[model samples]
Target chain A: MNILMAVLLLGGLALAAGIVLAVASRVFHVEGDPMMERIDAVLPQTQCGQCGYPGCKPYATAVASGEADVNKCVPGGERAMLAIADLMGVPPKEVEEEAAPPMLAYIREDECIGCTLCIKACPVDAIIGAPKQYHTVVESHCTGCTLCVEPCPVDCIDMLSKPEVLEEWTWSAPGKASLVKLEGDSDARVA
Target chain B: MPGLLERLGGLFGGGVDLRSLISPGGFPGGVHPAQMKITAASPIVQSPLPPQLILPLKQHIGQICIPIVEVGDHVLRGQKVARSQGYVSAPVHAPTSGTVLAIEEHAVPHPSGMGRQCMIIEPDGLDEADQSMPSLCDYLDEDPAIIRERIRLSGIVGLGGAVFPTFIKMLRDQRHPIETVILNGVECEPFLTCDHRVMLEHGDSVVRGLNVIMHAVAAKGGIIAIEDNKPDAVDAMREAIARAGFEANIEVRVLPTRYPQGGEKQLIQAVTGRQVPAGKLPLHIGVICQNVGTAKAIHDAVCMGKPLTERVVTISGDAVPHPANICARIGTPMPFLLAQCGLRDLSGVRLIHGGPMMGERLPRMNVPMVKSTNGILAMRAESLYSENAQEEPCIRCGHCVEVCPVGLVPNELAWHCRNDQFDRGQEYDLFDCIECGCCSYVCPSHIPLVHYFRYAKGQVAHIEKERAFAELSKARSEARDNRLAREQAERAARRSKVRKSGAAEAAADASDDTEAGTSGAESGEKAS
Candidate 1:
């Protein structure tokens, strides 16, 4: 009789917990694409597809589905990787080091290869022109993705580094100026 | 005496800056370093023009100036070389009669290494000035619009290191009416006394300029507040004010001498006994503040129609043989100015523009002086470096918090910034920090708190730019998606319409059976 009573009490508690969880799920249910969207918002949205997926959204969906690695996003760098890791509750993987200066694909307009092949390959369609006309890439819109170059017939496309502008300049990080060198400090992490 | 916790509680205790009790009614946290007015007694002298004047197009804040004259075109003294684009910008002018050598990029006198487009004028030794002058308007009865236009055309900007366009700043905010005009005579920066000298030598211009500024802003009256340390300047300014016949309207208030008493917020507070809330301007508090030099420029601009081509710059420091006040032309190269001042053989001396607290270290001496450059300092190398210096951890001693004029805890803000937690720093009022360097100067741990704050500000600005870029990219991508969807929908509709017509023609052919199937085939295809 004592064994039966213990089993029945434990079973009852388990049944109650299940019912409450079901009700909570029903009442506080989130709609579609939330996890994907959360991941996508953290992405740099270069849409360069260096992450094997067609675009940032597909990559985000793959990430949400636990299929793609967050570290595959080369353009997003370490910040995006860390953000994705935090969202996935997984350890952040090391991001591949990019060249110091970012490169953008430039088309040599003088070379008479107006084959519209690159236009089809560009994920964002940053290049603009008719079939036989000279095409030019909008530098601002170009995600510096190299996908379009693989389809160019004349091989006129060359990847060139982005130029530095005063508007985009950022100050260097502050160097610590104290001599005391206290082992323990502010920001609340253990020494 | 209140304990540290109690003082902190008072500071963080709601929005009231209780540190206002520093003086009877003064803002909190000001450090009075040595008053180093080394060149106060030096009389103002006009420096001979250098071989060429390199006038940077971006002398003021806002839109950079567009060059009006071509490279080979000759320009007259005071001739407008570069025209400002918008309301918030000011133009550049030729300092003396010269031929335009070249409008090319050159290093500007700023912390950044970025070059700006400068109009290099090869001075023609004649020193021919712009003899064409506008009739002086009686500013007392002159239309405010005409005066504002004249000030704008004169390319007048705040010369007290904050180079804001004077005309734009003078405009009274609709929410805050102009009640008083405070001519900032409180040259509180250490080692800089150009303002004081101007008040002494050109006292009449200073007072008359104040009257014109007051007229432009439509303020009731004006006040020229000076630090009591310059009794000679105070007396001279008072007599000048009396001579200008604005004795009834403009009063000279000598505030207790303190560092940054000349700061716009502090000066306004010193004169009016009111604290301008964080992120708010003096205009928000129904007061318009103008630098003393700016008022004098306004006087020159409106009365003489002469552009702001020259200014009285204090060339003082231990490295200079003669630390005299020289009336230097705008865009005159720093080397020429130094040569005129008899500069010492500089091996490791650091060239600092403006005051030590807020001034920028000159990257190269070729960087020409703009309107905002008030002082040219050459700190001896011995004083700048300390061997075996290393960064130490913050002790949370709260000395920085105690001295913060903006009532922000610099140590915590620095910590947040260092840890890459900018949002937390913003929560603690990071943007309100005036970057006065008081906290860094007063830090017991010797932490470069101001550097950290500046880094954080730059990081915040970069993040804001990223956010804006993301917003633009998002909008563009969404627009592209919409365009693709609309095109796809239109193509589908056309296909469906063609398919429906083909089906109708086939049915008609079937109804007609074998009568003219072959002949109708081509016609049916064409119709579809």
Candidate 2:
């Protein structure tokens, strides 16, 4: 009789917990969009498939499905990658490289007949000025696609490397591996 | 007393002995060095302003502010000289009424000895003041967000050496419930007593500022954690807390005098006995920690309607004629400051920022003191060690291990870093290192472990960035390939569809012709 009572008590407690869990699940359930459009919105609309998919949208779909890695986008770099990775429930991978030297488009302001071909070729509209006017590359907006450079009749546009600022400067990591001597060697080699 | 029962009672009832208070703060690690507080306490003296102020555009940790005033523009003391770019940054005000000399890159207070965009202000010596201020009473009825904005506009930052913009830190998300606010009065570095004097002299304001922070975070209580070495500071704070009627909510916790106890994680552990996990902030553990100096700055900005323009700097070293804590205006040159302290010839002197243990060694004394400069240390040539000290191999003395506050095996990390085995160093949790210099300080071999770690972290960051770029390029290539394949497939399908329709049309025409031929044959038969 005692054993039966103990079993019945355990069973009843389990049944009560199960019911409570069911109720809680129904009450607190959140409806999430299957598309995860918000996560895709933060991505650089550059359609320059840096994220291992055919386009930004396909990569977004893959990310939402947990099939692709978030750190695949280089144009977005660390900051963008972090936001996407956080949304996708993944730890941010180490930034693949210190942001590649910021690439800027330099227009030889003097070099030419102001043909607006480069301006028309720019996808992001980084190039400014109307036809027959001096076209300049808004350094901030120029993605350095070289599409504009090729279109320039006078070859005025050049992809210039960003000037090294103090903030942008990082310490060179000590090359310790190179200091080690070859196996069965006598002296340490500084390569 | 009954023996066995009494012992058991003592074990249970004697709720955690007073000695448990000596147990260190929450985090795994910290560093300790020789305390050099005596340099300043000898006497409190004033330092005169420099002839020229080279204020860097990017003094704090965030975006550099654009110079609102151009060259030759006349500016007054406390004038709004530069405007902040974003919420994470702070505005820079004119240190003293001066003429803008140049807005160009100049040598900044950094280890790399690199140049940064600096605003050179030639002080006219008029000391003209800007008396413009918002109504003080308005703050009493102002929104918390408005108060925060005022603090940011004031250019206040963590004067505890981190120089993080205080306003940004104060803006906490309400979603994360803050349980406790830890006020860091630990002033744990050796020879740095600026915070100590601030607490002793301005205890009321500090407490008021802490109250404001508590209100901002809606924290249940606040703790003022100070090392027991500063009993006078503790007493002063205690009196102020009682006077403010915050005795119930705010308590003064006297921590054991240990090096680096002023560190955020260590102090958190020593006070709360709750370890902030690796790679997490104290806020994550339901606590928000602010330096005593930062809290005082907040009070000044919110209550006094003042921007962070001046700070108390401890000028002390063996070589100085007189060492004292002086209220220095930001952008004061080190040479001029030293001269004010009666140091004439600096030909063979070594100047360091902050305390000698963790402070960076200045390449030259010409660098101006920015918001983060807490202490200026000058030592005679004989007393200073060469930058490149002869490094000896590790003798396995375990001194570095003993002094490490984070409980990391520094020797292992250093070994991996030295061997260029970054992966191995990472495996030993190299990122967890705070680079506090305790291991380097205790090392008999003078291995410069902190430098090795910095180098390794930089390398890792670079490699990681390169890998990301490569991955991006690969992804782009793959995407192009996929698009081409899809387009080709679509073109093939369209071509096949067109061919099928053309065959059907051809079959219909042939059937019509056959029908016509049959009709013609029938007509001919009738004629015959």
Candidate 3:
């Protein structure tokens, strides 16, 4: 009889603790992880689909869900890959492919047929044109994605390397050996 | 009614002792190196114009000017060769009558040692002046807006090495009315005595310029703050004030010599005893400070109708046998000035564009001296102390923290910067660092603490720019997608509505055909 009483009391205590836990979980339910958004924040948002995904957001979601590899973003290159890997707490892997140097798409406006295909092809709306109107790329917003280059039927679009302006120039990282080759006689210490 | 008591007590006068005013009430941290006022006693000498003058379009801190004169065009002295692009920009004037040689890239005096667009001119023998700039001789009675316009048109910028356009600083803020205008004669930087000579030679003009600035800002009181190390400058300035018969409104106050006491914020604190809040201007605290050199420039612009074509520069160092303060024209090459100061051999000397403390190392002697170039220092190899020493580890001695005028922890900031943790450096108030070099001077470890801070600041600014671009692109892409989706939805809705109307019309026709067939069948049955 004593054994039966002890067993009943212990079972009753366990049942009560389970009920409290269930109610507490419902009462304090959080909106849960925003891991995909965090991953998207690290992305360069080029939306070029070089990663085999439709856009940066879809790729971020795939990486967050472990459905995609982190090294597939070509435009983001190694920097974005490392950042994503760090966010996911995984070892960084080598990029699957190399990317071209930074470039911006320029349209030969005179040769453009004004079909507006490149405008529709640009994911960032960097190109602005209407049907039967010449299109020009707004260079500031152009992510150097090269998405609008292939859609031009007349072969008017050319991907040109971004020009260096004095305002955008910056000092390189301190103590890092710079690989900038000197041109002409522009030696720093002429004296 | 200005008095020593009123000047020491600041805008709000109180029965305060001058001793307490000089103590814990002034600017926070500072260091006193050797007061190398070696050329203070030398009279100003005029420098001959070089054969070619290279004027950089972007000498000031604001917008770069656009060249208005084309190559091969003749430009007269003080001619506006480059027009100011924006309200904050200063126009570049021809230092002397010359023909434009080329508009091409040339090396500029920057820490990066990079090339920028410069307008090269070959000066003719005649120094013909452009007298179009109107002189507001009665500037004291003129409207402040008109005076500001004259200042802008004359292309006058801060001659204190800041090179900020003076007109922008004079723009009045209705919320914080300026009370006191402090004339900063504190040439605290070692080896720089251009301001010292400017005060000694042109003290009356400086006083007159202070009056014009006072009129421009509509401030009642003006105090000329000079370092105590230059007693002659103070006496000269006082005599100038008395000669102008403005002694009742202007006072000359002597401050204890300290490095960077001439910094705009530090001078404000030292003179006014008010700490300008972080990320705020001295104007916010009802005070505006102008360098005494800038004041004299303003006087020249307003009274003499002169654009800023030349300035006083000090040429000093061990490399030169005779170090003298020379009145040099803008766009004069460094080598020419150094040669003028008896520096012929450039074999073993390092040339600095400004003072040794805050100046940058010139990559080449071909770079021209801009309007703000105050001192050209050619220190020999022995004078460069601890610059090439291998950086040692921080001992946490906190000496850098003790000397930082902004009171930022330089050691930790340097550590974060060295470790590539810029955000951590920013959390320790990295932007507050004025790049004063005080921390580097005091560092026992020989760490270039200021270099790290500058590198981190540049990196942080670049990263911020990239992040901003990314955000802009992301927003644009998202907006484009939403626009396309909305257009598609509207197109589909319109097509669906048309299809629905066609289906209704077909249904109506089918009903009519059925009714006719039923009527025909009924007639056939009746006939049968």
Candidate 4:
């Protein structure tokens, strides 16, 4: 009789807790892709589509659902991958490729065939051209995605490394990398 | 060198710690490195023009000037070759009569060692002057706007190593009233005595320029602040102030010797006892500071009808045989000046443009000196501190925090910067750092703290620029998509309207034919 009373009391308490949880979930039901939005915010927003998805948003959605790895953005490189890894609380995978220098798309105006195909391929709308007219790339806005380079029939587009201006120059990190050293062969690490 | 008591006597010839009487609540944190002023007593010598002068258009920190004179055009001495593009920029002038050789990319005196577009000129050696703007000897009665315009046209910049355009600082504004104009004669950088020599030699010109500057800004009081290390300069400047007959409004005050005491903010705090708020200019705190060299340049511009084509440069270092203060023309090559100072070997010598503390280490000797080049240090590799030791990890010793003049936590900022955690760095007021290298000088671990801070600042700026471009690209792509969608919708609407009208016409035709057929059938039946 005592065991029966204890079972009944425990069952009633469990039922009350379950009911509160159900009601709280119903009241605080959230819609839409909050996780996807957060992942997208961490992206570089180059929209190069190198990650097998359509754009940064679609790639972010796939990552949010665990369908895609975050290490595929070439334009964003390791910086974006590490940012996503930190946000998602996952162990970061080592980036296989070396980090490339920043680049900008340049157009050879003389070689351009006035096809306007490359202009349509640009995701940033950085190219300015009309049909049967010479096209030029707005160097500042071009993300150097190489998308425009592939679509050009005449192959007028070139991805060139951007030069470091005086205003953009920064001092190098300390330690063995510094150029102002005496012995010059101090590359041995302590660890 | 003078004894302690003699130096302590200062401008009064008999006083102790006079700085307290002048400034109350002096600045908080500072470091005292050795003052290696070996060439302070050397007289100024005028240097001849080099064979060629490479004039970079953007010497000051603003928009690069646009070439007003074409290539191969002969320009007179002190004539404008490049015009100022914006209000914050200063123009480039011909240091001597010369013909433009080429406007092409060449290495400049910058830390990056990158090439910039510089106008090369082959001097004719005639040194003919361009007497276009007449001298305003009686500048006190002249309109302030005219004086300000003359300063702008003369291509004057801050000679205190900042190289900011001077005309912009003299703009009269009523909102932030400038009460005191301080002529900064504090040559506190180690091994740099260009300002010291200028104060001792051209005190009258400095005072006269101060009077003109005060008149332009409408400031009531003018104070020329000097360090106690240079007692002779103090006496010279004081004598000049009395001779000018403006002793009531203008005075000379001596300060204690300390590293970075000549910084624009530090000098203001030492003279006015008011801290310039973080991220604000000295002008915001009702004070305007000008370098002594800049004051003399202003005097030459207004009273003598001259443009800033030359300045005194101190050539001193261990590698140099004769260290002297030479008044060199702008655009003179570094090699030429070093040769003038008896420098024979340059295989292992580190050529630094400015003082040892904050100068840029030049990689090559192809670059030419600009308006802001005050000292050319050619030290042996053994003299540099970084050369002798390797940087170790920070032990959290808290020495950097103790010496930071701006009161920033260098160790924490450096840690955040090393990890690329710039958001955390901003939370610690990273932008308020003046980059004075005090913390780096005092760190026991030999950590390059200033270099890390510079890297972090550059990264922050680059990130901001990238974010701006991303925003712009997003906006552009969205607009394009909306435009395409709108055009497609308009075409669909037109096509549907046309189809509906065509269908209605067909139905009307069918009804008319049926009516006609029924009428004919009735007629036929009646006839039968």
Candidate 5:
């Protein structure tokens, strides 16, 4: 009889604790936003549609809604893709092979004819010049969209590859065979 | 006192501070090296200006300042000679009154030995200071935001090696609460003692600067971390803190003398016992670290309304006749500095900037002293230019692992870096390696582990850039394909519509002809 009473009391206390926990959870639970602003913030503000979406915000929204993969943004590359993947609780996918060589806008100054057509075509306003004057490219602001190239009548605009500098150079990773060689050598008999 | 409770308490405490043992302050790891700070005992001396100053526009780590004065334009000391191009960049002021000789590209002090855009100033030796002075005291009563803007307008940056803009760091979000402001006084680099002398001479200003920084960030408290090796500096800072009546909020912490202990992450760890996570900043861990020299600069900018025109630099190493710290004006050439110290025989002397460890070897002495240059070292050729033997394979003795302050696997990272396998290196947390040279210092094989890591990081970044371009092209091609398919479908639909209209016209004509035929037959029947 005593054992039965003790078991009943313990069970009642457990149920009470659970009910309290549930009520506390309801009171202190976080309200998640339907839109993912954090993912959007991680994206480069280029809005170039290189991510298979019309704009960066749309791609961010798609990722948040699980309608699009996180690795679709090629301009943002692996870092952005990984960050988005981590935020959305998904594994980072291998970047596509075609997404190589970040392009830069180059102006053929001779053929420009001082016309500001490319300036209006640029979405980021990377091209700078007054009307009927030679225009220049602000390399930092240029998103390499190639939109400006299409509008130039003289075909003066071209996409150039960014030059590699010592500052930007990184070392390649050592091969797996080297590690195996190290392991094998260590296991070999000493002379 | 001899009760059971007392005995139990005694057993637990043992009259010792438990905090001192077992990962005290949670500092990850560090290295020990020769301190070589005996050259700073003498007072600071000034060096005569070079005949010509090659002042690079891109000295700091941001947009290059554009030169406002052209060739033949006369300038005075402390004058706004060059303007800041963007918000993230700092302005270049006239180090001394001089005539603008030229604005062209020249050889810059860099590891790559490349040229940068620079302004060549020819000093007239008139030593006339800029006459304009704006009252800074009036802004003391004004809004703090306005004061910060004033500081930014003055073009002040961190005088430390990392020349980050000071105002950007001060403008913090109130949501991310800052708990402690750490003033780094531990100049851990060997053969450099400029910061140590600054602290000894200007301890009051350093403390006041700490107060200003704390006020800017709304931090609860501040701590000045000095190495125990510099007892005199520590004592001076402690006295200054006491005199300011901030002994409680502002405390002095004496850290173990270690190489790269002055690094932002390592210093934060030593003071607060907090470990900044991999790929995160000290701000993320509720801490902000600034150099001692930067603190003094901040104090000057706030009180005197002066921009960063001059800084203290250490001129030392074995080759110099007189090794001393000099308060050098910006754009002062290294040759002039070496001449002041009486340059030793070049037959066996090798000159370097900063320190032997982590400092770049100078290609020529013509490179001007920039904001990041802390020391100008001239060592014996035998010591500085010793031929290193070929690197042998790692013995797996774990010396590099043991010395790594960030707890990263350097051996594995270096292996991956050497073989061009960047993905594997990233998996081993290659980004976390601070390039402190601890791994190389402790390695028995004398492998350049830091070099390997730097190379790996560059490769990974390049690959990332390439990948971004590929993705962009793929999207463009896909869009083009979609557009072409839609256009083809529309053209086929238009052809079908035209054919249907033509057929309907023909049928209508045939119906009219049939009506005519019926009229003709009726007329014929009437005639019969």
Candidate 6:
């Protein structure tokens, strides 16, 4: 009779604990596409479709849904991949190849075949031209997506690397000046 | 005035015993370094003009100033040489009467090491002040807006190394009225005594400037904060407060000599006992903090109608033969000022702008001094900036945690930074760190904790910039897609209308043919 009473009491306690846990979860629960938003924010958002997805948002969705690999965003290089991996709570994997420096699409103006195919393909609306006139790209707005380069019928469009300029120069990370090192070196301690 | 009554309440004249309320209160971890104020004995001496002045257009912290004077144009002393671009910027004035020789890129005294637009002027040495300057008005009797305008026109900025335009700060929100104004006199940095000297010599001007600031903000009261270490500074300031008869409007608060006690947020907390929320200004807490030098500049601007051409700068170090405080002109080259102090050998000397603690090491000595320069120190190789600062692994001493004024886990932030986990560092409120170098000073491991924090901050800023660019691109892409869809829809609608009109015309032609056949048949029957 004592054993029966103890079992009943333990069952009641478990049920109460379960109800409390369920209520706590409901009270503390978050709403909205927080995971997708987080993943998308980490993306470079070039909308280049180089990752085999349509754009950065679509790829972010794919990564959140576990449909695409995190290492696929080549334009973002190692930085974006690491950031996404961090958000996903997964160990980062090495990419086979790092993305090269960003390149802007340059159209050879004299080629004379402005079929406007490149304009339609440009996701950023950086290209401006009539159906038959010469086309030009707004350099600032161009994402170096290469979408315009592929659709050019006359093969006149080419991607060029950005030129180095002083205005765009930024301060090197402060770590570059510090004595901190990943490897242990002699003469390291100074107090 | 209520401002006077409040000041009286803060003093012992009222019921509140302010001595009990006065304590060294601030944020989290911090370190108390040696005051090293040996140069406090030197009185303010006017620094002689240099042969050529290199005035960088980007003086105050904002958009670059637009050069109004062309090459070969003669500029008088205190004449506006450059126009301020926007409300956030301050106009740059000619330090002395000179001819604009060239406006080219010259090495500015910035840590970035990149040269910006600098106006090279050859001084004629007449030191001719502008004769047609604006008329001075009693700042107290004038409208607050007029006072702010006069302050802005004088090109006065926070001389506490922040270089933020003073006028912009004075324009507080009406919803949150400024209740208190604190002039930061706590020169907490080691090897810097310019502020201490400024108070001792120009106490009346500093108090009047505080009054003008209070008038501009319509604040109830003001406090001139000084370090307890500098007893002379406190006595001089108190005397000045009494002389100005502003004993009721302003009070003297002596803070314990601690590193970063002069920090805006730290000083605010020390004086008001209120913590300014992260990412919010002191104005949010009904407070406005100005530098002691800035207060003096405001008094000069409003009373004499003079522009901010010169300021009291502390020139001292072991490498210097004669270390003294000198009233130096803006845009004066570092070499000239260093020579006045009888600078020693330059080869092993590490020249730093501002105090030795937070001062930036000069890439080269020729960089021109701007409005925010408080002190210049030339340290011997083995002295202030120790070359043998051997960075060792963190021993997890919690010394940084104890000394941090912002109450941050600096070692953990440094760890995140070391491993390139800036996101995690940000989660720990990395930006909240003021980079006061206190953690590194107290660290037993000599880990250069501030360096890692700075690196982490820079990385976070770079990532944020990239993210902002990406957001802009995405918005553009979405807008472009919407435009294309709208245009496509319009074209489809137009095409359907054209098709419908053609169908109607064909149906009419068919009816006409049937009518013609019936008419022909009827005519044929009648003929028969």
Task: Please give each candidate's TM-score.
Answer: 0.87, 0.69, 0.84, 0.87, 0.68, 0.79
Q: For candidate 4, what is the DockQ-based docking class?
A: incorrect
DockQ of each: 0.15, 0.08, 0.25, 0.23, 0.08, 0.20
Q: Please identify model 2 stretches exceeding 4 Å from their true place.
A: A1-107, A112-162, A173-191, B1-32, B40-44, B126-128, B135-142, B380-382, B385-388, B468-528
- Encode model 5's per-residue lDDT on A131-161: one tens digit a residue: 7788988886677767788888889898999
Give the candidate order by descending TM-score. Answer: 4, 1, 3, 6, 2, 5
Question: In CAPRI terms, where does candidate 2 land?
Answer: incorrect
Q: What is the C-alpha lDDT profile of model 3 across B1-528, one tens digit per residue? A: 235746765644465433332346477678899877789999999998788888999889889999999999999998899998877899989999989999999977665557799999999979999888778888878989998988888889999999999998897778989899999999889999999999999999999999999899889999999999999999999999999999889999999998889999999988888989999998999999999999998999899999898999999987888999999888888878888877766766767778877887664566788988999888876677633677788998777776788878899898899887887998999998998889988888888888788888888887788778878888987898899889777666755655565467567775545545554465445333
The stretch of ten residues in a row with the least summed lDDT in candidate 2 chain B is B16-25
DockQ, cand. 6: 0.20
Question: DockQ: which candidate is best?
Answer: 3
lDDT of each: 0.80, 0.75, 0.84, 0.84, 0.75, 0.81
- What TM-score does chain B get in every candidate? 0.91, 0.83, 0.88, 0.91, 0.84, 0.86
Candidate 5's displacement at residue A169, Å, is 5.6
Model 1 off-target regions past 4 Å? Answer: A1-32, A97-100, A176-191, B1-21, B131-133, B172-174, B385-389, B485-528
Can you write out model 6's per-residue Cα lDDT over B68-91, one digit (the tens) per residue? 999999999989999898779999
- Tell me how much of the true interface, by contacts, candidate 3 captures: 0.30
Which candidate would rank higher by DockQ, 2 or 4? 4
Q: Once model 5 is optimally superposed onto the true structure by TM-score, how far is the C-alpha of residue A106 displaced, in angstroms?
A: 7.1
Give the C-alpha miss distance for residue A71 in model 2, angstroms. 26
Which is the better candidate, 3 or 5, if ranked by DockQ? 3
Predict model 4's lDDT versus the native.
Answer: 0.84
Better of 3 and 4 by TM-score: 4
Considering only the true interface residues, what is the Cα RMSD of candidate 3 after superposition? 4.7
